[model samples]
Target: MLRETWAEIDPGCIADNLRAIRGMLPAGVKLMAVVKANGYGHGDLEAAEAARQAGADYLGVAFLEEALRLRAGGVELPILILTPIRPDQVELALARDLTLTVTGADWFRELRKRHASFAGRKLRVHVKADTGLGRIGFRTMAEWDALVPWLASPDIDVDGFYTHFATAGQVDTAYLERQARRFAKLMERSKASGIAIRHYHCAGSAAALRFPGLALDMVRIGAAMYGFHPARPAPPVELKPALSLHSTLMQVKRVRRGEYIGYDNAYRPDADEWIGTVPLGYADGWSQRMQGAAALVRGQRAQVVGKISMDQLMLRLPGPFTPGDRVTLIGRQGGERISFAELAAHIDGPAQAITTALTERVAKMYANAKEVRCPWNNAYFQQLRRVSDGSRAD
Candidate 1:
């Protein structure tokens, strides 16, 4: 029987991309693999495990739920929650041993009081100073300075200090340079106040490429490490595309003159012609606006026709066609290639449509085709091993 249509992710491609990213940094420069947004919609656990095996020093997620998912997947590497946790999540945060990012003195004080039992453990926390991003962070140097001394106490362990660049990825080099200068001054002021922190990082994917100085003690590599190059004068290094989408032709038929096709009579044949329908459409993350867009069929471009339905789309081929023929949606087809960025541009502008519209309807299978090892895969395996033999290997 044919399997349900799904997206096949290449863990090896992710591993290769991580290797390429690590090659660019200095020997001691730390690398925190940013796996937010479910590893950019590739499934976080699969991506996180591959990333750790490929030498990622740390894992960064946007919220507590994502971090918990990683830990549940047997990921023991330090996972940092990049977004601010509400006062309510402190107990959950403490229970999971997850690190929290603090932007204000009041927030830190409350976290310490909640974890009073683990006073000696020193709840791991990071400080966010607003250098110039004007986002969620300590807005002034005075705010950070006042908060630093409290951290010096035994209640907290300030593991890192960082900030975000407002326009690094979308602007020119000069804009990034100015942000770097402001960041440097902020670090200088923090040092002058005698506040010591372990890891200092601010450079994201774009800033890391443009300004190496921004990679102070660590760099949180996001989309770039996954083989995507954000906006820069030029990419700091070459990268690979880690994701590919595929489908198969379901049926092919000939239509009479002026015969309409699909819903709403959106497409009608000028004369007798052959049309092929593939099992993909808006419900599967293929936009309806791409009705006239193109796809790769037998190593050539074919125009889409009619309104895309929930589970199918029609394409007008040059001549006769057959079912089970390969269809390439976002991969190489001989000399022709269609990229996600290209698809996004065709449907809508970058901000609203492209990346954001790719829904989770596409199924994801691993390229290696290994059996997935989710919690349901086994019962009482690892903890039992740890208890009987005193070894923890799963």
Candidate 2:
């Protein structure tokens, strides 16, 4: 059997998180699910379907290639490419019918030259205003304001105006308010120039929860859909975690006292102990520092007792552990569940310890999609759904 080290995505959780976000937004304010960073390291396509089923009006990704991938997958959602696009990719963007964040005329001109057919097509566009974030956007209010005429041009469809918040989820509320005020000013300037940008989004997952009513036309949600909170507290809503990391014990051996484990002599058996080696480690997204950390062994805590090698880790059980036992690295063990935030905090950072370090070698399995036999195949999702629905017995 293939090693059990993989990220498990629960599609049902995606639907639930979107429902929570939609309930918080004002009625008619749109919801755009941001599926960037491969859906924050949880397979993007699976998360995208979950978000869509949960009532997302639009989908956002960070790059043109990502948007293209979604389209190639037969996903027909209206996707907004949040990154500023180069002229070369504009044709692909047009061919794929993607909404791109426009920064200046040179880039737009390049698009116009290649996709002359765009003159007839309604190219939905969002202007990226650099309202103090100083990232990819129009640098000045005047520069942004001047785009109104082009935005209104019959050739292009100016659908939205948005700004990113540098402090929305990480800093003081007072600072966030200031950034919001700047965004408001930018909107007013756009209005004065007669550019009726229909959608105005300025909130990410962090801002959406922290600044509740600030959902202008729509809110962009990324991490929240995967069941992670945005640094600040959102309105009270039942949030379900959508991802779980798991593995099975590959071998169980009795270690003599003073025996070193794995590489570099990182961990030694405290006493004569039974150690279960699992096929998981830094190569599979389990953190190297998790040595001396804990994994859930059949709902009880088992301490990781060795250096996390590239493809495996050792866990010391208080008693004898069998080779076939299951281990939970990021899930509930009985009544106790390990949160990623908690896992990250345990190793001196956010539970980003594993998710952030997830390598491409690891496979992602979806419990809600059609199952395929391969490690990345999601065919078993139907079986999982049936079990969840009580249609099939365990």
Instruction: Go through the candidates in order and give each one's C-alpha lDDT.
Output: 0.73, 0.76
Model 2: per-residue Cα lDDT at residue 138:
84
Question: Candidate 2, residues 1-394: lDDT per residue as tens digits?
Answer: 4455556778898889899878977889889988877777776787788888888889999998888888887778899999987877766777888998998766666776776656467777898877778888886677875666567778788888898887775756777788888888878888888776789989987788767778878999876777776333444576778888766778889999998888888778667988888888776677677777788876778888778888888888867766656677888756667776667666776443356578777666767455642454343433332332112212
TM-score of each: 0.84, 0.88
Model 1 lDDT tens row, 1-394:
2422445467777777777766777668888888888888667887798888889888999999999988888888888998889876877777788888888988767765665446456678888877677778887777877787677777577799888887776755666567677778878877776666889999887777767766788988877655666433557677666766666677889998899999999999889988988888887777788888888777778888999998899998777866766666776766788765666557644322333345666655565654533332222322221221111122
How high a TM-score does candidate 2 get?
Answer: 0.88
Question: Which candidate's TM-score is highest?
Answer: 2
